[model samples]
Target chain A: MKAAKIVFGLLAVTFLMAPLVTILPLAFTSSDLLSYPIRSFSLRWFEELMISDAWRMSIVNSLVIGAGATLLATVLGTLVSLGLRRSFAFSGILKSALLLPMVVPAVILGVGMQITFIQLGLVNTHVGVIIAHTVVALPFVIVSVSGSLAGIDMRVERAAMSLGANPLRVFGHVTLPLMLPGVLSGAVLAFATSLDEVVLTLFVAGPNQRTLARQMFSSIRENISPAIAAAAFVIIVGTVVVAGLVLLFRAAAQRQKPSTVTV
Target chain B: MTASMATSRASGRGSTTGRDGSMAASSARVAAMNGASAPFIALEQVEMMFGTHRVVDQLDLTITRGEFVSLLGPSGSGKTTILMLLAGFLQPTAGSICLGGKRIDHLPPHRRDMGVVFQNYALFPHMSVADNVAFPLRMRRVGREEIEQRVTRALDMVQLQHLRDRRPAMLSGGQQQRIALARALVFEPSVVLMDEPLGALDKQLREQMQLDIRDLHRRLGLTIVFVTHDQGEALTMSDRIAVFNRGRIEQIGSPTEIYDRPASRFVAEFIGETNLMAGKVTTTGPDGSLIRLDSGEDMAASAADWPAAGNEALLSVRPENVTVQPVGTARRTERVNIMQAKVADSVYQGDHLRLHLDCGQRRMIARLDRQVADYAVGTQVDVVFQADNCRVIPT
Candidate 1:
């Protein structure tokens, strides 16, 4: 069994990592084109991307939207999760609605939101784009945090309450800390989703609010450049780092967690 | 919408003659009116409903100051619901509850000054043992020095002071339960409620924890309302037990009173191992009675509340109280309540022998003191119990 497990693990590693190796090295090609096995590597593309207005603006916009989406989704999702968890009212319908964005087609969601944003006079605004990204991102946050909350025994909350902390104090002191890893994992996913968002950005983002994915889309459509490859390299590295941190936090949280903690 | 239980208090009216319960009645009345000697924690007509099915029918219970009370029952008997109501988690559907002479039924759980230890220890995982123990103090904003002193003392009480710096995840199940207990008691609330606190521990560990909890209650003189489905636990830990059944109080009395003289058929069957024989009252006398069993033979079973002649009743005899002997014994004076039977099966249980006897149409169980000295299966024997040991309850 142990030997079989090792073999399975090796197979998974090869399957997951081989594609990354192929895609990543193309970023450093000395040519002004995308190719592997470069004759020489240079920071020329990266420097050129730094000077480009569109590239710079997209990077800044990604940061703004990513941070905004993370904060909004984490707060709203965490609070909603706590509410749904503590009470039986409307839970089934609420959970389904919150999870809908995760399964629905992004194109469909973008179209629906575009119409809504136009009616609300929010289309072509940064706030509109952030809201659209958050609509797609909130589910991930809710699932992550709520999954953690599910694993937590509400008994801990009662224990706090028994010790004389009221509802708000119990949430702030006992609950939020115990489930922090879960909340952070959700926030990471939300930020990462917004950072790579493209379809929603195209439908609703203002000229100033264009995301990295939107900028990359236009570049590839008009003229694919090594600068785009350099941006991709940066994004790939950043994503791996954030995703890795999330996996680590989740693993750490799960390792010490009790199986019967009332999930 | 919230409903609270307002159990009618035993009003301090009407004096009665006492067995040396003389002028004490008048003093007791004055005390009741003055709100003195009232239970530190009292559940008054507490009811809980799950949809329209009343899970906790009107329950009236009182825990005197510094007394230990246990709510004992099988699952779905609403023992845990009663504990939750006391903890302020479930709103009692009918009556008001009083804690130390103050109405606290409407108070939120946190403001009720009661500590609860859950079946699964609800220790905060991110915090160390000291932090978890100090949580109540921190919530109440006690001084840091005082918090330190109290946490250390509480940990010491549980003999876990050395492990105080460790997180709860590092503790064993028994240790975690102890920490839970210590955390609950450290706050020095007027009352502490435990909801099946030892349910998660192994048998040996559970036994030790029971003694530990009992000792703590004694040492601290704290009022406690412990809820458990384990009848043995209730017997071991409680000064008095409230046995629950189908959302109603089956019986409430001291442990031995509940065991030796149960008030109802449910209480008799629930508290211990017993052999029940449904019968009709054939004769009644001043000292004892004889009842005809369902198999049409008269057996001498006795209870104070034995019904009049021809009334259908059930007889409950404890297994250990039944004695087996060779048939046709000639002592003559010790032959009361004798039944001729054959031991159809026997199992040696090290300390006691458990015998299954086939007597006419009824099979009876008898627990004998000797394991090895027992009749072989299918051997003819006389199963006898004293008239006092055979208790009769109304069907």
Candidate 2:
């Protein structure tokens, strides 16, 4: 049974990783045309990504939009979670409504947002793309932050108030510090979400506001070069680095936790 | 503000004296000033309702300055609710609270200037012990030098200065509890409210902390309002105890008064283990009353609440007050009530023996020293108790 289970797990991992395994190595190929077997390895495709005007512009756009969306989503999501901490009669309904963007099809959200953006004169702008990305990223921030917020012992905040801290001071001194790990991880998730978003960005962005994901989509249709593979590699590595930082932060937080032994 | 600061500085200096010598002098001063002035904290007709479920109903309580009062009851008995109301965490639905003769019901918790110690210690995990102790002073914008001096003195009060640099997580439960105590006292608030602060500790640690807190209360002349479900803790640490039942106070008095003369059957059963005998008063006088038990026995009980003739009453007798003797060993006395019974069971405790006696249709228990001769099952014995030890409580 154990052997069968191990075989099943290997099959699942292979199935999940097959596309990344086939595509990532092409990023290092010397050939201009993307091929299955690499004749040689070179840094030329990566250099093309950095030196080409359109690719360089797209990468910068991705970073700008991702950071903006992450900042907006994290602030709004943390506020919503704090407001929802002490539940009211409509709290469940409000929470479900907040998370509706997660379960709703992105195509539907894109169409709706595109119409709304047009009415608000936000279409074909970086602000439009960032706002679009924040709509989808908000749910992840809310979920992560709410999980950590729930884990906090509210008595600690009460203790702060009893020690002569007003409401704002208590939040700054106790509540914010306790839930910081959650906020950091949520920001990372929000940035990653905005970095790779394609459907909504394609509908909302113009040619000048093209993001990395939109550039890669057009490249796949028009050229299919190794430069596209380099962009993918850059995104994958960025995500891994961000996730690693979050894990390090979590480990440090765990170390600072008090020991549970009763004396 | 200047006058209050001077008084606080004076008390801070008083705390620096030797523990033994200062305890005597401070406690005597406290006793002398206890009831001579108005109450330090007063709750008048306070009612707290949670969506129509009344947690505290028309409650009135007063704590004199320098008195340690414990709100004792079972869970859901409104004792913790009272503590929360006093701390300004939960506002009473109606009525008012006054501290130092000024209405404070509308103030927020931080503005109320009261310290609260939670059951789980609730120390900031990210802060060092000194920072936790210095939090209130920092909040008040004290100078850095004064903050350091006060934090050091507060940690010294709890004897935890050596662990000032450690986080709360690195400390044991007792150490964390002491840090919480130091943090609460560091500000020298007008009142200190503790909600079962030692509930998490083991029995031995709890007993030691009880003595520590009682000693601190005496030495510091602190007015503390403590809430605990443990009757023994209240009896040991409180100057007066308010026994709560069903969102109301059943009885409130000194420990001895509440124990020796519980006003109701609930107070009698809640405070300690007592054998309650149902009876009707046959005769009553200023000194005592005669009651006829339902099990066909006549017993004398001291007067309680002035029970008139033929009123239903309960006779409460502590187990330790009853003496068990061999059937023919005890002689009848005028003031002692003696009954003949058969030993149904005997439980050997470490320091005492619990004898279960079957007398007619009722069962009575007597706690005797372990050195007393053991009685076998079905052996005849005499159960003896003085009339003064048996309290008559209204049913």
What is each predicted model's overall lDDT from 0 to 1? 0.81, 0.87
Candidate 2 matches the true fold with a TM-score of 0.94
Q: For residues A161-198, what per-residue lDDT tens digits would candidate 1 score against the true structure?
A: 98999999998998888789999999999999998889
* Chain A only, candidate 1, TM-score: 0.89
Q: What DockQ do you compute for every candidate structure? A: 0.41, 0.49
Q: Candidate 1 — which residues are off by over 4 angstroms?
A: A1-23, A35-37, A86-90, A255-263, B1-37, B282-286, B330-335, B371-373
Across all models, the iRMS values in order are 7.3, 6.1
Clashing pairs in 2: A258-B169
Docking class of 1: acceptable
